[model samples]
Target: MQNERATDTQAALGTDTAPAGIYIHVPFCRAKCPYCDFYSVTDSDRIPNFVDALLKELKRRRGRVPSADTVYFGGGTPSILTPGQIERILGAVHDAFNMMPDSEVTLEVNPGTVSLDSLHGFRNAGINRLNIGLQSTNDRTLGFLGRIHTAEQARNTYRWARQAGFDNVGLDLIYGIPGQSREAWRAELADVTRLKSEHLSCYTLTLEPGTPLADRVNQGRIPSPDEAVVGDLFVFTCKWLDDHGYRQYEISNFARQDPGKGIDLRSRHNRKYWNFVPYLGFGPAAHSFLDQCRWWNHRNLAAYLADVAAGRLPVAEKERLTRDQQLIEAIYLGLRQTDGIDTVDFRQRFAIDFFDYFRKAMVPLIDGGLIQLASRRVRLTAQGMRLLEHVADVFIQALE
Candidate 1:
């Protein structure tokens, strides 16, 4: 039965007609952050075992994907692994998959976890892009977020990445902290733009359920994030980054474009997620989607490791989307990007008239200056992004 399913999935995935990506989730963290809900544990001792299990999984899933053009090492903190370990993993990836020669290999690094020499080693280990987690420029805010590194260390890490010959570097920042003012966020943007990294992702902090931050808010220890303030900061950031020569590609991602050189710095791996391109994720809590089916591994590290050790695919759940579910996701994911949904492509793919089907829902949104239907595409205006849920809900309800 499993062989039959694999045969059907392979037939559905096709022969690499479209670009695909690989995502490796490194689940070990130095310490768990209060606001972070992503699966990670403080078990530093298990790193070696985790790497071995990951390699075994990679070998087992060798022919699952035909080709990959992007490889992203995302994490609880991928840089916590030594450069030699990273090299060994990449070597295994090369042996197990058909990696493109010009693949955009990215590694997520947190400040203070990486040193200058180690950064150089990572570069030599085939990591061509670096995404540094510099959540804030304020020390107090960093402390509040339960981050292990200071503001200065984040800056030093960025500098060291450049010194290590990494030209394509991205930085992540968070705004909308409790009691944060619009002006404070503006200053934070000011500080980040000065670094002029190739890419910047500015996300508004969300108090995810079960996270320490959420507990603090629930217990009245910390004030909840102000939505209005976050909205203002979002607007300011869009305009600020635009004026600073950065193009907003996704809702939170801004890439610096050098028109003269034709350098587009948008994250290639992430585009797969938004565009429904085929990609596979490996690790605890990792989710994967190809064709109309999506599956995820066990979120628990022990379960994941045990399954891999037993030479079984560690997937915990799988779902083949119904047409309605696919349409809902198309709207939800399409609206997250600046490119929006291409009406022509939508009609061809799903045999539904994009504008006509959603006419009722798009009317109020378009009239309210929340979305724009132009150039054969439907995209959210800056205001719409602030109320993305409301906009998506309107479209989703119409589909229902």
Candidate 2:
């Protein structure tokens, strides 16, 4: 059965030419956050080897490369790489693929890992955007979150990026952390708004099962924030950001001042994911979606390197989305954007009237103030946006 599934996935991969994005996974960090489950090693020695393997994989996948409009280096802390190393990897990208001239290239940086000089080096290396993790603005909350940088360090990094002439900067923040108060969260939001970032991503802390955070909660060493409080905080976030001139473009993301600029300034690389565009993800545990199939690299670093060394794709697993599955995905993905799902586009792609097909399912949500259909576009209301996962599930089940 597994072999059959793999064969099906491989067959699907050969069928279509999809829009492409590049995601380079930097699998090294100074220290792993306890809440993080993403694969990364603390040993710096592995980085050079990893970079070599990554470049090799790029060469091997060159034939499959499509013209890419966006390239993202996400990580265990991509900023941990030297400027030269980043430049080299990006150089390989240019060599292997036809990168669009106006491609939005983003590098993720941790507050502690970046300096003014490094930020300048990154810009010179062709990274057009910097996403700095500023999980919280309160020092105690920062320590509790196990972040290496203090609140001061985070603020300085943001300033440094701006001074370095990076106008397209993003700040990532987390709310609903254990022991974080409403007032504290409000203050954090205010501080971030003051930074006048081009983009902001706010996420509620989730205690993933089997993570250290989960273990602490189980042992009563830490308490989970009440769900009701977290829900309230989510609403507060949308209102606060919207009032401060940041538009909620997606459920977790907002942008500063200009709605036109905000709409134009979204992470083009990330938009591909929501649009179900094909992307090649390189590095251990990175997942790739191509044609109608998805495959993931081996989670084990050794296994991934061995496979790459042996001239085999380091894929650990693969799945081909069924037509029904694709339809469901389109509904969920389309609903995630602020522009929402377009009735015409849905019909054009799938030969189905999305509205007519899902009217029964959407009626209840609309009545409950969870969704709104305006100007032939369907989008989640502010209330519905807070329960996006639940709303997505309803739409998914309706496909059945």
- Candidate 1 per-residue lDDT, tens place, 16-130, comes to 3566788999998899999999999999899999999999988988967778889999978999999999999999888888999999999999997999999999999999999
Quality of model 1 by C-alpha lDDT = 0.88
Q: What lDDT does the true structure give each of the candidates?
A: 0.88, 0.84
lDDT for each residue of candidate 2 in 101-190, tens digit (9 for 90 to 100): 888999999999999999999999999999999988999888777899999999999989988889899999988987677898999899
Q: What is the TM-score of each candidate against the true structure?
A: 0.95, 0.93
Measured by TM-score, how close is model 2 to the native structure? 0.93
Error of 2 at 279 (Å): 1.1
Clash numbers, per candidate:
0, 0
